[model samples]
Target: MILRRALWEGLLSLVEDAEDVPWILLGDYNAVIDNSEVCGRAADTSASMTEFRDFVTAAGLVHLPFKGCPYTWHNSSEGSRSLWKRLDRVLVNEAWLGAWPQSSYLSALPRTSDHSPLVVLGIVGAQEAKPFRFDNFLARQASFLQSVASVWRHPIHGTLMYGVVCKLKNLKSVFRSKRKEKGDLASNVRQAKEFLATAQALHEQHKEDIFLVLVKCCRMVYCAAVKMENMMLHQRAKLSWLKHGDQSSKVFFRKINSRRARQRVYQIYNSEGECLTEMHKVTDEFISVFQTLLGGVRRRRTIDLSWLRSDANYVLSTGEGECLILPVTEEEIKEAFFDISEESAPGPDGYTSLFYKAAWPVIGRDVCEAVKEFFVSGRLLKQINATTLTLIPKVQMPSQVSDYRPISCCNVIYKAITKVMVKRLQQVLHLIVDQSQNAFVPEIIADNIY
Candidate 1:
C-alpha cells in the first residue's frame, strides 16, 4: 500500500511537470479501477483503489477499452481460493485520446506467466470512405422528413430504375450536407452552456419578465444540447443504453476505439516470407493474394445428367418446373425489401434496407420496377451488384493474407432479389433432392456409414 501511494504521487508529479502531449501509461499498475474489475473475491472499499482512482482523476487520464479476457492477472489456486483482477491497463490523457481515438488494448492469453500480455495498437492512418448508414438520431430532427422528401420528389429522366438510382444518389448528397449543417455536438453543447450562463446572470440582475423568459429558453436549449451529445455518444458506442444501464462516456468512447483497432489490419507477411508494414504494400499483397485465388483459369468439366432421367425420383414434376421460372411480382419485391435486416452492413454503394424502407413512399415504385427489369432483361446493374470484400482473420495475430477469410457484402437490393429466389427454391427443394443427400436439406440425418 505504501509503494502504491508512492507510485501514485510520482505519476501525479510527472503529469504536472510534463507538457499536454499525447502519452499512454500502460502495464501492470497493481491496482483495479473498480469493484467490477476484480473477480473471485469481494472488493475492499477501504483498499488502495481509491488512491489509484484519485491519481487517475488528478492526471485527467482515460482508460482505453480492452478486448479478450477481462482479467489481466489470475491467482494460481483451486476452488474458492482462485482470484482474478485487472491489474494491467492502458490509460491515456485527453491529448492521447484526441490524437488516437481509434487506438485499442488487446489482452492476450497468458503463456508462461499468470499475467496476460497487453498489446497497444496505434492508429494507422485516415480511414477509407465508410459505407453510408441512416442515423436514427437524424429522424428526430424537424427538417429531416422535409429534406428527404425534397430531394426524393425531384423528377429525373430515364428508365424507372435509373430514375430511382438518381434520386437516391441526390438524396445522399443532401443528407451529407445536412449532417455538416448540424455542426459539431461538442461545440454546440459548449455554446449552449455559455448562453445559459449569460441568460442566468441577466435574470439574476434584472429579475424582469423578459430576462426570466430568456433564462428558461436558454435552459431548454442547453438540456437539448446535452441530450444530443449523449445520443451521439450512444451511437458511437454502438450499444443501447436503455438495455444496459447508463455507461460512462469515457467507457463508450474507448469501446469505439477498441472496435476500430480490432478491425484494422496493420501489417501482413507475403508468401516470400517478407513482412509488409507500409499501407500500400500490405494492400497490394492482399490484392495479389485474392487475385491469385479468384482470378485463376480453370477447366470446366461436363457432367452428363442422363442417369438422373433413369431415376424418376430425382426429376422435378411438371408443376414444380413451371413454378421455378414464374415471374417476380411487386408484392414479392416489397416483401423481399422488408424481409432484409435494417442493421446489416452496407455494401460499396452505401445503402441498407433501412434507407429503402424509410424512403419507400418516395422511391418504392421505381425500386420495384428496377428489380422487375432485372428479371425481364436477365441482366443486373453493375452498381447494384457491386460488393465490398472484407477480410476476417482466421487465427490470432495472422501474418499472411491466406490466414484471413474474405467475405463479400452485397448491396441490399441484390440481396433481396436473391433472397426471394432462394425462398421460392426452398419450397420445392425437398421434392427433387435425394434422401441420401442431406447437406442443404433441412432436418435430415446423414450418419456416418463407416
Candidate 2:
C-alpha cells in the first residue's frame, strides 16, 4: 500500500512538471474503478478503493472505454476460488483527449498471461461535414439581407419555434450559396484594387468616361471587401482593443493562430504507460470520462431549512411578491431583445442579434409570439434552450479538464426571455434581498457606503 501510494504521488508530480502535452497513463492500475469492474467477488469497498478513486480525481485522469472483454485479469483457480477484475486498462488527461478525439482502446485476449494486452488505435483521416456558423460579415452584404428576407417570409405551418428553426435552416442554404458567389474576399480585394489603379491611370491619361466609371466601381467594391474582411477578423479575435479602431488584420490573425495552437491537444498516455496517438482511442476516452462523470451515483441528502424560519427580516411586501410573478408583456420582451449587444455571439441557431435588429420588421411578430408562447406554456423547444459549452483554459498549458472553465452559449431567444425576467426581478429584488448582498441590486453598494 505504501509503495502504491508512492507510485501514485510520483506520477502526479511528473504530470505537474510535464509540459501541457497529450498524456495517457495506461496498463495494470491493479485497481477496479467500481463494483461493476469486478466479477465473482462481492467487490472491495474499502480504503484502498477510496485512495485509488482519489488518485484518479486529483490527477485529473480519464478512463478510456474498453472494447471486447471487460475483465483483463483472472485467477487461475477452481470455480469457488476464481476471481476476475479489470486491473489492466487505459487512462488519459484532457490535453491528450483533445489532441486525439477519435482514438480507441481494444483489449486483446490473453494468450498465456493472466493480463490482457491492449491496443490503442488513432483517428483515421476521414473528412466530417462542418457545422453551420453565421458570419457577421455576411450581414454587410445587401444581397445577403435580401436572401434572408426572401427565405424568412415563406410560410411554414408549425409551432412558432418550429417555424423559426425551419426558416433558419433555409437561410443557411441561402448563406452557403451567397458564400460561394462571394468567392474569396481577400482575393477579390487584391484583384479589384489592381484593376482600379490601372483604370484610374488610364482615365487620367485619356479622360475617357468608361475608364473613370470602371475606376469608381472597382474602388467601391475593394473598400467594401476590405471592410467585410476587417469585420470578420474583429469577430473572430474578440479582442477589446480591436473594437476601438485597432484594425490590424495581421495582428488579429496572429492572435487567432496562437489561440488555436494553444487549444489543440495532440498526445496522451494509456494504461501500461504506453502513449497513444490514434484519434479514435482519444475520442473514446473522452466519451467514457464524461459519461462516468455525468452518469455517476446520485446521492441525495436532505438539508434542514429550520434555521431560515427563525429570521423574521426576510419577509417580502405584498406588492413586491405580486411583481415577482407578474405576467410577461410584449413591450418588456421588445426591450429585452434590443437590450442584447448586436455583436454578441449567436447560438446554435446561427441567428445573431444584429440579424434580428436589422430584419425586425419581417421577423419581430414571430419572435414576439414565440416568447409569449413560452411564457404562457411554461415550456420551450429543446433547440431554443440548447447551448454550446466551450472550454476556456484557466491556466497556461493546462493538462486537465478541470483547468478549463465551461461557458454555455445559449440561443438569442433564450437570452431575450431571461433578460426580461431579470429586469422584472430587479424592481422587487432590492426590497426583499438583504442590503449586504448587493450583486444585482442597483445603488445598493452606494447606499451601503453612505
Candidate 3:
C-alpha cells in the first residue's frame, strides 16, 4: 500500500515538471477512484482510491472523457468470483483542457488482453486543404460593409447556400482591392505617423486655422492606422488574453511564427508501420486514418428511449416537444449571431460573426432566408456543411499523427444554425434533465459533488 502511494506521488511530481504548460498523463495506474468502478468480490481498496484521488487533486487534472468499455480490466474469473475495474485512465491538467477544449479519448474492450486499449482523440488533427484565411481586420474597415454589400446585392441563381458562397468568393477580390488600397499595415502606420508629425510641425511654424485643422485630421488618421494594425496582429496571433494595445506586436509575431512551425506535420507512420516523411504522404496518411476510424457499423439497433421516461424525475410535455421542432425564426437567427463572440474562429467561408453583425442590415433578409431554407427543406448546402480541419501539435517533438490534435473549424453559417437549435434545446433542458445530474444542466453546478 505504501509503494502504491509512492506511485501516485511520483506521477504527481512528473506533472509538476510541465509547470503551467499544457500536459497529459495517461496509463494504467492499477487504481480506481470510485466504488462504482468496481464489480464483484474485491478486497478493500478505499486507501488506494483516496491516494489516487488526492494525487489527481494535487495535479489539478480532469478525467479526459472517454467512450466505449467502462470497465477496462477484468480478472477473467467467471460467475460469482468475477472482478472488473476501470484501471486505465487519461488525466490532463487545466492548461491542457484550455488548449484543446473539445478534446476526449476512447477505450476499446480487450480482445486478447486483460485491459482495454486507449486512444487519445483530440479532434484527431486536420486534413491538408487549400488555405483561405479571411482577415478579421478587413471586416473592421469603413468600406468593409460596402464591399460585402456590393457582391451580396447581385443574386446568384441556385441554392440559397450557393448564392451566399459565390458572393463570398467574389468579395475576396473586393476585399483584396480594399486591402491594397489600405496598403501594408506597418507601412501605413509609419506613414500616418510621419504625416501627423509633419502637420504638427507646420502648425507649430504657422499658427493658422487651416494648419491647426490639418494637424487634428492627421492625428486622427495616425490613431486609426495604429488601431487597424493592432487588430491585424491580434487576429493572427490567436492570443485572446493579450490586451489590444499592450505593445504586443513583437509578441504577436513570435506567437504566429511558433504556431506555424508546430502545425507542419513532416512525418507519420502509416497503417503498414512504414515511416513517411514527405508532406503528401503525411496528408494521405491523415485522410486514411480518419476514414477508417469514422467508418463505423451502418447496421444499428434503435435505442428504446421509453425506459428513460420511467427513470426520469420529469419529462417534457407534448407542447414542449412540439416547440422544440418548430421552424426557427429570423429573430432567433439574429439572436444566435449576436450571442457568438465576434472574434470566434471563422469557418471555411473566412467570415466571422462580426461580418454578419456589421452587414446585418444589408444581408439580414438573405441570411435569414438561407438559414430558413435548411429547416423547411431538411437539407443543407454542401458549402454550408463545409469545414476546415486544423492540426495543432500536442508535444514538443511529435512523431505520430496522434501526437497532433484535430480541431474542426466549421463555417459561421453552420454554427449559427446549431446555435439556434441549442437555444431551443436549452428551453426544455431543465424539464428533461433530472436535478441530480448537475453537469451541463443550465444554471445547475456540481459544486456539492466531491
Using TM-score as the measure, the top candidate is 1
TM-score of each: 0.67, 0.65, 0.66
lDDT of 1 by residue, 102-187 (tens): 67677899999999999987755767775565554565677766787887777888766677667777777777776678798778
State the displacement of the C-alpha of residue 395, model 2, in Å, after optimal TM-score superposition. 2.4
What TM-score should be assigned to candidate 2?
0.65
Off by over 4 Å in 2: 1-124, 207-210, 243-246, 268-276, 287-312
- Which stretches of candidate 3 lie above 4 Å from their native place? 1-130, 204-210, 271-273, 296-315, 446-450
Off by over 4 Å in 1: 1-23, 27-97, 101-134, 154-159, 189-237, 240-248, 296-313, 430-450
Residue 136, model 1, lDDT: 45
Per-prediction backbone clash count: 0, 31, 1
- Give, for candidate 2, the lowest lDDT window spanning 10 residues: 264-273
The candidate, 1 or 3, that scores higher on lDDT is 3
lDDT of each: 0.76, 0.74, 0.78
Q: Which residue pairs clash in candidate 1?
A: none
Ten residues in sequence with the least summed lDDT for candidate 1:
240-249
Candidate 1 to truth, TM: 0.67
